[model samples]
Target: MDSSSSVKIVSKHFVKPKTIAEESKQPYYLSPWDYAMLSVHYIQKGILFHKPIHYSIDAFLEKLRESLAITLVHFYPLAGRLSTIKTEIPKSFSVFVDCNNSPGARFIYATSDLCVEDIVNPTHVPLIVHSFFDHHRAVNHDGHTMSLLSVQVTELVDGIFIGVSMNHALGDGTSFWNFFNSFSVIFQAQEINKNDDLCLKNPPVLKRYIPEGYGPLFSLPYSHPDEFIRSYESPILKERIFSFSSETIRNLKAKVNQVCGTTSISSFQSLTAVIWRCITRARRLPLEQETSCRLAADNRLRMHPPLHRDYFGNCISALRTAAKAGELLENDIGFAAMKLHQVIAEQTSEKVSQMIDQWLKSPFIYHIDRLFEPMSVMMGSSPRFNKYGCEFGMGKAVTLRSGYAHKFDGKVSAYPGREGGGSIDMEVCLVPEFMDALESDEEFMSLVSF
Candidate 1:
């Protein structure tokens, strides 16, 4: 975790440990549907490596155990009724293949002598996860590509990294973040309590197999023309954190509003337009390419009888729109602002939100492919910043971000509470060339205003 330590601590080793569940005296035929009932989701496991100087790994682990116990109380099954819902992790999870089987889902599996307290300088905690995959993932495919889920802790001041790989079917960002924050409270020694009214009576039994009728509302005629092919082909994925003063962005917003009509636009939308122009120009793709961006809209309001912060499950929806990148760039910034606001407001509805959930329940399951596509660079706003405050009492988080998810051409994550007022820490991951170009170009850099 420290700069002083050698960076080569990630031992080139692959290990997977497995044990089958003890044969119960009684056997039960749980339906395959039952497995879907439980919290397929995991509490995200990230590390806080302390400098090991004068601090024993044993001591740190003990603190971890205490934290774990506190977190476990808040851990509950997802809102559903499936026999295996609360099923303990399966033997099939890591056995017969590759996965370190990281202990406690978060811990320091030391590869070297240097510990956290000794770390005068430390890298991001998530880097550790990357190092493992780069070095440890089995080249020989052994049926378990879902191997990254078993988060492990390894020590080697080489550099600390935090990793969080959740089950895809887990709660939506709203619910998942709620779980993350709840778990974080244990570190703060705070209590994690469910909403008093959140009684789990008559949970939804809708099978994920059948996508319900959100049709007509969700269905749009997609007749593609040859030249205007809406082909999204490319393995685009990477993210990097970029900072901007809130004052600058606010001024940009005001100027944009004055130029455009009274239509409200967010700072995220304005920035997205600027980046869209840059990317369109850089790729040398169609100047008038119908570049579409999807806003990741939260749908806590979409459910019947209404769900609140604690109602976990995919409660997020997307609102997508398109414009000629060339035209967007030519107009004042406010034009793009109106574009973003219009697209988002249109999407902000129970009709669309339910449509998404219903679509998930449909027999025609093509949406999995859609998740990887870049969706407005994913601006996650209003997540509690208490995770950053978690200090081993060593120091505060200098910088934090939602790291690169290797599935988009580029994506951005906005975390709350920057040093300046009303500014969110924005992490932008794009093609390496774009990063280079952004660094070099005055005009593009000015648009981002970092």
Candidate 2:
């Protein structure tokens, strides 16, 4: 059977919130941090689970559909659509969420002929995985007409894939996982006592975190969203998963600390350094060329007053560190690790506040094409997220996967290993030539378990 055509959609519909109060249907303003992500693509991520035994597929889908409605009640902004307000006097535009005009979140039910092994056992993730997510190649600004949140449940012969495509402007990775976790909690609770009222353990703090001098709405620099939108066709890229066990990660960290004579290097930093170095070597760029690594850091705790962890919007800052290709390649892993550690340490409350204040004065939107500069690597999604704990009464997830949106030559996403511990799984994307070079680099593959 053709893998691309294997996934067949059984039904598709919209799931509205169980209940929405009239007063709660007011506009939800976008934070400055959210405005900065206006042009980025939607975030597409999902989990692969072993098919549950003893439950009919019909019954399972019904429960999932019901719980989704209940979950939307708490995460109401997701059900809402983006609104572009224009002012004639100023000839400017601003965007906000119109809660009153919600058309509900998109829900899809699909069936695939593939099995668990078809997804988990491949060195390169199969192309069929891209079919699991909706809103393919759609940017976050498309939320003005598209659903801000889309959920797809694709059933395999021996597994299930629950894919979610969320608007990047609405939240960051922290917010994305929070919604997934909350949905699982409500789903599992229904299995226990269907009659009981479900409540989120960490209910989302929906208040927008605007700076002291900033108002709820900020005007876009452009007159229309089209002027700010960028179009780019992605090149053919290969994606592979590299697994690092707890022991391997420890050894990497210990090696970095031993060389640097400091214990400040974290496992994440150590791992990212190795990838940056290896990819640089694989690319075979000129010594004089400059390379950079950009990582997204959560800002909820870095705010002046420290916003709640449950804050339901974009609260993140990109930490970028650069080096000449020659310098990066000549240095040991310790050198690269320390560079990342230093940048991470610099994101203090004052620094975060300054970043917010500066952005308010001159707001800039991130274009998709500009995200992938040459010789650059972008690290997204942290291993700290509880990817495996999203249990819907059907055991833990076997692994995680991402969709086609926001993918570039050097995009890397980190996930906690399925076996737990400090292990990590990096979903790496690169050109075919670069991937071949990376797979053959023994020094780098020596640390990878798979």
Candidate 3:
């Protein structure tokens, strides 16, 4: 069967919170960090699970919808819509969440004839996977009219895929997973006791974090979203997951430390170093051309009066480390690893605050053209997130996959392996030519487990 054509939408609707008081309907201001992500696309990710033995699609949908409504009560901003306000004093516009007249979160139920293997066994991830997510290609700023959060449950022949697309302005990976974890917990709890009142172990802190003396609302530099937001079509790309066993990671870490004469190098840094080196070689860029790697650093713990772990918003900044192509390729893996380590180590609390303060002063929005520079690689997501731990009574997720949003050549996402114990699954996206060369590069594939 044609997988794309076989997939059909069963139902689609907005899922509102179970209970929200009128007094609590105040506007939730977007912070500088949140505003930085206004032009970026939604954070699209999905979890694939084996079909439960006694699974009934109808029953599962009912339970999922019910649990989501309860989850929305705590993550109320997600159920709200984005609103733009004009101020005459400075003649600027500010964006905030309108909690009073929320249209609720979008929920979709779909069905497909494909099986689990059709998704996982491919050498290159099929484009059909992108179909699983709603609000395809919509940027975060589109939340003004579109739903801020969308959930699509696609029932496969022998599996289930739960696709979640959250506006990047709403939260980061940490916040997104926190909401997913909470939703799963409530879903599982209801299975055991439907009448009991469920509670989140670590409920989200809704208050926006702003530096002292800064306005809670930051004015947009542009007069209209159209000034920054634009349609972007990436070059044809091939995505593949490169699995690194725990032992292989350990070896890489040891090699980097031994060569650099420093024991502080982490596994993630070491692994990313190898990826940088190999991809540079594959692209075969001019020796003098500059290349950089962008790492998404979480600022939750790096803040002055550190925000709560459950802070429900974007608290991430991209730390870029650049080197010439010749320098990166000619040096040992330890050199690249050390470069990453130093950049990450330098993001102290003061540094994070300074980054935010500078952004507030400039108020620049990220455009698609500015995001993907030449010879640049961006590493997003993290192996440390509890990707495999989100269980909604159908057992843990078999694997996690990302949708087409924010995908560009050299975009890499890291996830913990299904078997767990320190292993990592790197979901790598590169142009067709680069992907072909990287797959054949023995030096890089030597450590990758098939």
For residues 150-194, could you state the per-residue lDDT of candidate 3 as single tens digits? 999999889999999999998999999998888888999889989
lDDT of each: 0.42, 0.88, 0.89
Screening candidate 3 with a backbone cut-off below 3 angstroms (N, C-alpha, C), the clashing residue pairs are none
lDDT of 2 by residue, 263-369 (tens): 88899999999999999999999999999998879988987799998999998877999999899989888888999999999989999988877888788888767
Error of 1 at 27 (Å): 15
TM-scores for every predicted model: 0.64, 0.97, 0.97
Q: What is the per-residue lDDT of model 1 for residues 107-226, given as tens digits with 9 covering 90 to 100?
A: 223354454443323211323334322213221111123322233344555334333333323344554444445444444442234222232332322222222342211211222112
TM-score result, candidate 3:
0.97
Model 1: what TM-score? 0.64
Ordered list by lDDT, greatest first: 3, 2, 1
Clashes of each: 30, 0, 0
